[model samples]
Target: MDEANRSDPPKWIQQHAVYQDLMHLDVGDSAQVYAFFLVYMDLTEGEEIAAVVGVSCPELQAVLLEGREKEGEPVQMIYPLPSHRSIKHRELRSILDRGAPMLLCAVASDSSLVYQTV
Candidate 1:
């Protein structure tokens, strides 16, 4: 695995109680969890920009890929996920800025993915 390709979840997600439990119990490695769901806060536009990157679900990946394909950008940034869904930094920032926070939720069958940050 390329060290540069290893991405970590956003700090807010890392500080969440559910995330803490997972880390404490060693339920999964950081890299593996990241492969499924990625969340981050971008503080570039004088405020916090939060985004949730989901690649574990095939349906979502297809939707995003199809959308990107229609947009004329055939290629996207590849991540460590099995499906190979891509998300570039600039695109991520755009998603974070225009995308709503609720869209960041993990869209998967795992009940554990649902959690309240408080």
Candidate 2:
């Protein structure tokens, strides 16, 4: 597999201070919460992504919990697959598509947000 096709965490995840901190968190749930926020950023676009950044931890937790209870908005659908198999195929395609842009956003420990596109 090419470098982009490798099934490994992206380089930004390895280098980001906030992501590093989240990984080191003793509470597994806390780490998952923050991870979900990172995923949320990736799936969101334009103003929605901006709106979610810098939210307090408690607010982030609430949004994550709420998402689990309901279907996500249509705009948030990253793929059109109706089955798990097709979704997995699309995910693999996404991983291999090196030219595709990935957005990385970090919420610092102090609750400040920064965004970068790669």
**Candidate 1 C-alpha error for residue 47, in Å:** 27
Q: Provide the RMSD of all predictions against the true structure, rounded to 1 decimal.
A: 14.0, 13.6
Model 2, span 1-118: residue lDDT tens: 1223234446766676645554554333443334444555444433343223221223212112111112443211111111111124444344325333333334443333454443
**Residues 25-118, model 1: lDDT tens digits:** 4424454344333322121122332222222223223212101212333323222222223345654454434333223223222222322211
Off by more than 4 A, model 1:
1-3, 35-118
**Relative to the true structure, how large is the alpha-carbon lDDT of every model?**
0.33, 0.35
Clashing pairs in 1: none
Estimate the lDDT of model 1: 0.33
- Each model's number of backbone clashes? 0, 0
